[model samples]
Target: MGHLRQIFLFLVSIFIISTSYSQIEISGQVFDDQDEKLIGATVMVSKDSVSSILAYGISDANGKFKIAVNNESDVLFLKVSYIGFGTFKKTIQNKAQTLEVKLSPSSESLKEVIVKSEILRQRGDTLSFSIAAFKGKNDRVIADVLKKIPGIHIRPNGQILYKNEPIQKYYIEGLDLLEGRYNLANNNLSVEAVSKVEILENHQLVRVLDSLEFSDRASINIRLKKDITLSATATAGIGAAPLLWQTKVTPMIFTKKQQAIVTYQSNNTGTDVSGEISNFTIKYAGVNFDIDKKDWLSIQKVLVPPFSPERWLDNNVHLGSVNILQRI
Candidate 1:
């Protein structure tokens, strides 16, 4: 009887292990017709629920993106597109399991709009928005259009959440800036530079040691336009709470392979106000960020730190805390 019990217990343990773990690692490289790697490509996946992006990522400078999927899916789409290359797509079946895709370039015959519209993405679970979707009625800031995208909610506290999860980071053309703290309602990023705003869900950071895959966490990547301009944007006025004034100016300058991004902002209103500046530069090919983000509340407070005690007590009499939830 004791021996019989041991066999039964073994079977139960096996079942538990099988039921509790169901995941697959999908990894590969992208190459052009001549076999040249295409860097900074976008990749995404979602469940057939049609609800939101389930998994998303971008190819590295070596032209590679990695994603992990679980259980099963009806179909999978793989796409590849570069600035000068044509967009290509393919379909995969569940039975096929692992995959490696190669995207080809297109001729200049059709209109540029048609080419950019699709821009080579996996068709099955990926969702996308055209540049047209971002055009505002008048001079709407970037946050205006972001509010329209499904599965995205710009909170009153100025934090951007995708599928009930706070986006761990933000990047302009794959460059991490301000750590995704101000993406919610602030119009810091110009729609023009944003060739695409990739929402990488369940993103994992890749460990270079080649031995730490099991311990790495998800990360995010942003794809920007091929060429852009140097410009600044400013918005200042008195709102209901922050009765003083607010101003933000960012001087952005870039080259094909280099950039100097500087942000200088100052606000003295009511509940929350301060001055800050940040600048960083990275090689287009050398580095990328893979973050294991935690404690989102701390990050938000840091982004919109409270004003001085004097500022808060002064507003306490009648005015409420400054509501600076619109700009980001």
Candidate 2:
């Protein structure tokens, strides 16, 4: 029994020596054509028979990779692939235990990836929409063009909604042309002058607190064409008998460092032009300050029944407003 046990131990030691000799450790470094280390690159070793993968590893941040192969007799092939880079394949001989691979940039792969129907594209925190893709023949003004955008809607009251939420700020060339009353520019601005519309989501209004503060609101910016630095819109109409007339003139100028918009609107057709005026009064802030006596007097008197103010106030209503914005 002692002699048999000695023989069994000798055979087991030989088997372990042979197994260790057959196994080989492979190490390599991957780099780009510019000699920059490529992280997360796939390094694979497969049998020359094209059967199964023998070993695999991913390049680390230092572009170093290590793999192990258990079969030393089988001829192997190494493959390395990464995004925006060309694939590399080479035969691994029995004596070659270390490798260094440099992958070239794949321009052919980039050409094959063509984006033909991309109307909206996102970059960082801003989303840009191509104007030509959304504009139509009947889109005479910017308001008309905005209605055709997928995630944007223009209400009947000229309010702008983005993804079902109202936009907080409207900008022209990175300048807030209208403080809170942006309907003036949206309704009157010409669509032909605009080249693109950018939506800044989760925008931070205050520049100093941008990193510390966060907001859910979004802001819109209009990018005009290169040659369209100056644009204007004018409308004039007249009717006989009752002498009904309306006139609107808007002129705008946009530049890299300065922006200005001047508008004059006058109508007597019962249009509510009070929206153009800046009213800082908040209904829910619990601060009661009445600047207009007529407003308080109307609220104090209880009416007989709820009625449509539009029907009751059928009289001629003359409204004239002038708004000018200049940023330097």
- Per-residue CA lDDT of model 1 for 111-141, tens digit only, reads 7736563533433233355444344556355
Candidate 1 error regions (>4 Å):
1-109, 112-120, 123-128, 180-186, 207-220, 226-228, 236-246, 256-260, 274-328
Candidate 2 residue lDDT tens string, 1-328: 9999999999999999887878788898999999999987777676763544455667887999988777666568887877677778898774447789999887654643222112355566787766875687788878888776645777655667776777767888788766656766787678988988998988887788778988777889988987448778888888864786667777877777666667777766445555544331223363323221213334455473465454443345444455555544
Runs in model 2 lying further than 4 Å from the true structure: 1-118, 275-327
Candidate 1 lands at a TM-score of 0.43
> How many residue pairs clash in each candidate at the backbone level?
14, 0
Model 1 residue 299 CA deviation in Å: 18
The 10-residue segment with the lowest total lDDT in model 1:
318-327
TM-score of each candidate structure, all chains considered together: 0.43, 0.54
The weakest ten consecutive residues by lDDT in model 2 span: 286-295
Give lDDT per model, in order: 0.51, 0.70
Error of 1 at 191 (Å): 1.6
